[model samples]
Target: MKNTSALFIIDDVIANQLLELDDEYIGYQVLHEESFYKHLLDVQEFPVIDEYSNKESHKALLVIRSWQEVREILKEVQKEKNINAWKRLFPCQLYADGAYGEDTIIQNLSCAERLLIRAVQEQKYVMFYC
Candidate 1:
């Protein structure tokens, strides 16, 4: 469990279930670590973050967003096909500078980006949290 950041959109029933018994929650692979958090921050989509437990804080920090907002941000992020888009939303120091370093981050996230986009399009609550 190196990184705990989870970006997902789920139906209300699933959200409610997890709210009750989070032990059953299966983790999603973190697409981008710092950039994902920065993206949430840039969009002002903050919920309570549980800093102490770190990876285990997902249940405590659960937040729901309307699919419209999710769609808009996803659209903006999906454009660049590179970390340049993420860097534009975030800051310089968070990522290593150079094409190789940046592309490493961006290239691996294609599947995650697609899955998240699908979730958003389904009009579920898109979330970024534990």
Candidate 2:
């Protein structure tokens, strides 16, 4: 899982279960290795992250204790100002190798926003696997 991150949005019950059991389980794959954290940092509303541990396995999990916190974070992510900040951070550019370019980062941000909106609407909690 080097240089990659995954976001899982699960039902509150499932989140509680995982927390209680101190284990990890697969859930709705919202973002997989999209590297949205940089963009989140640019927006200056990065969610607090905590470590989720089970035996030798450990992953960074977004510290969201309530749906209201999710909504608050979502609001910051959806703001035009924040979106523009991402745009400035990832200005469009071309690469001769045609690998993942600046546009990919922006696209990832947009996709994350959509999924997080859905999570808010569905009242789910998020866990970041890093």
List clashing residue pairs in candidate 2. none
How would you encode candidate 1's per-residue C-alpha lDDT over 6-123 as one tens digit per residue?
4443445544544564454434333234433333321212111222224343333444456676566666785446455544322232344343344545654554465456666666
Please report the TM-score between candidate 1 and the true structure.
0.41
Top candidate (lDDT): 1
Top TM-score model: 2
Please give the CA lDDT of all the candidate structures.
Answer: 0.44, 0.40
Model 1 residue 68 CA deviation (Å) reads 1.2
Positional deviation of 84 in candidate 1, in angstroms? 5.1
Instruction: Tell me the deviation in Å of residue 106 in model 1.
Output: 0.4
Evaluated at residue 24, the lDDT of candidate 1 is 41
Flag regions of model 1 displaced more than 4 Å: 1-64, 79-100
